[model samples]
Target: MTRRDYYEILGISRSATPEEIKKTYRQLALKYHPDRNPGDKEAEAHFKEAAEAYEVLRDPNKKRIYDQYGHEGLHGAGFEGFNNFDDIFSSFSDIFGEMFGFSPGRRSGRRRPSKGADLRYDATITLEDAAAGTELDLDIPRTETCEGCTGTGAEPGSSPERCSACGGKGQVYRSQGFFTISTTCPQCRGTGQYISNPCTTCKGSGKIVREKRLKVKIPPGVDTGATMRLTGEGEAGELGGPPGDLYVLIQVRPHDTFVRQGDNLYVEIPISFVQAALGTTIKVPSLNGEVDLEIKPGTQPNQVYTIKDQGIKHLRGGGKGALTVGIRVQIPTKLTREQEQLLRSFAETVKDTVKGSGKQKRNFFKGF
Candidate 1:
């Protein structure tokens, strides 16, 4: 029987673009995957058909040949067979190998040592410490190189011996039709060497857990979520590999008087009703020290005042940001009889003189 068209199997048009072809194939493959549709013969057949379609359509040259001859011109093209389930598995292995830097066909006898794992630690600092920058001494517990046997994992004078199971070839070959695949040797565990006598301190492992102290200098203007990296400060590598790095994540403590926005500082200051009406000079807290700020007379509530060069320093080498002070007028919650009378008298004097006063006829008509 003649096979169906590759594009028809993937539910895509013949003129479909490369992206459309891949998207359709991926959707069909995921829907009919053997793992997702267990023991379903129809789904498995559809999955195989989708994979075969993608293999041809993904390549422009192969797609052209298939389009011209409809699988007849592609006959005896020396393409590997996929008649069995193992053949399908081998095809998947080749696709994944090309994508992730691992192939089942290529293997050397020797195994390369792997690097140590990276370490992460949280570092919390006060807002003051963040502004001024400070040095922090941290004690971190991690794996370090074993001193016994000098990290060789051998007992005193004894040494490791070559693995006899795989003939020191860390990998073993398995035959699959016309192809040979290499897999890590189970007996040697890909090390190609075995330790007859292990070190008592590390027990064949080249590292041990220990506490280490590190001094880190935090730069000024580093806010929360900033990370500082220390090279080669993580766990020691095994079998002479390179050590990993240490990451210090910064966490800034909340401040009572200041709210930071980028490099700028925002602060709310309370001023009396008299100070808001009749200008006054008030002391405001700055990063350096307290500074006198002039409150203009007749200042409205929630009016913002900017003091230049009084904020935190810019993190990216720019000049300092301005300190914005938002003034809030405080009204008396409770007043004595004498104070109430005085405020009443003052309110009556300026009642009709203001622009919004109902009695001011001229100001009201001026807008019209």
Candidate 2:
């Protein structure tokens, strides 16, 4: 039988771009693939026909020759079409690799498989939440295989077909002067298959974007920039592949009353100068509650007091961290006349006591 026109076989115009040619062939191949349409002789013939058309149109030399002299020119170049399924698959092994993850071969048979993509989310928590573990419900938006189409990208009761252009390999090759170069088949877009009856939901993409709610348990002692991994909780996988993982990155907001370093909590407590001078028991704030902290007599400003077992909880262990309290003595900014008189009197006593001592370095201008 006389061969059909290459452009007509792929359903493309004479001015069709290379990409258009490839895309059209992919659609044809998928519709007539042997695997998809088993026991159908007509489908097999169509598969071979698409592959032949793709082989010629994909190569510049063959395409130019066929365009000038049609199939007669290819006969002169001694180009015989593929003889068997093995020959077709072998010629397009690299193309199949792009369509599937692996190349087609006798030992490595084709299988329906896919692997999900990982996802990340950022969460901000208060210091209290970090000290005590908390549970949260997060709504994660991601792409997953369509439930309606079951990731096939085809309408219900329908199926994807082998790419006719690339013969289900999803790629094409052309011989150069000395080297053979392989490229992605424009027809199938490198999927090695095509969906003629596309699923309306996913628009033939096989995946959908939706939000899913997941419960996340945040561990205690998780600080800023800490990462929590949730296995098998990421975006859903394609086809029958396993689901990916979800990563929750923690961002701890600064606290108004406390600063944390490792397992220690640092807080500054203000005390009146009188209290610092006379010693007193004051209330200190901790993660759990308030506790009594003792201020020694004549305590200086910026002195640190450590309270054991009162800070943040250990992330991985049993013991709690220490609470460090720094004393900030406040001098009276505005004093009453009586208070001023008392302070002046106290200063005089200090001066007199120093004068009474044997130290004789006092200058005469000191009294003035």
Best-fitting candidate, scored by TM-score: 1
Provide the overall lDDT of each model, using Cα atoms, as 2-decimal numbers.
0.80, 0.81
**CA shift of 165, model 2, Å:** 1.1
Q: Model 1 — which ten-residue stretch has the worst lDDT?
A: 96-105
Q: What is the lDDT of residue 189 in candidate 1?
A: 85
User: Could you give candidate 1's per-residue lDDT for residues 39-72 as a string of tens digits?
Assistant: 9999988888778888788889878888887677
Q: 183-254, model 2: which lDDT tens digit per residue?
A: 767887767787899999999888899998988999888899889899987877766588899999999999
For each candidate in turn, the TM-score is 0.68, 0.66
Which portions of model 1 show Cα errors greater than 4 Å? 1-106, 352-368
Q: Candidate 1, residue 141: CA error in Å?
A: 2.0
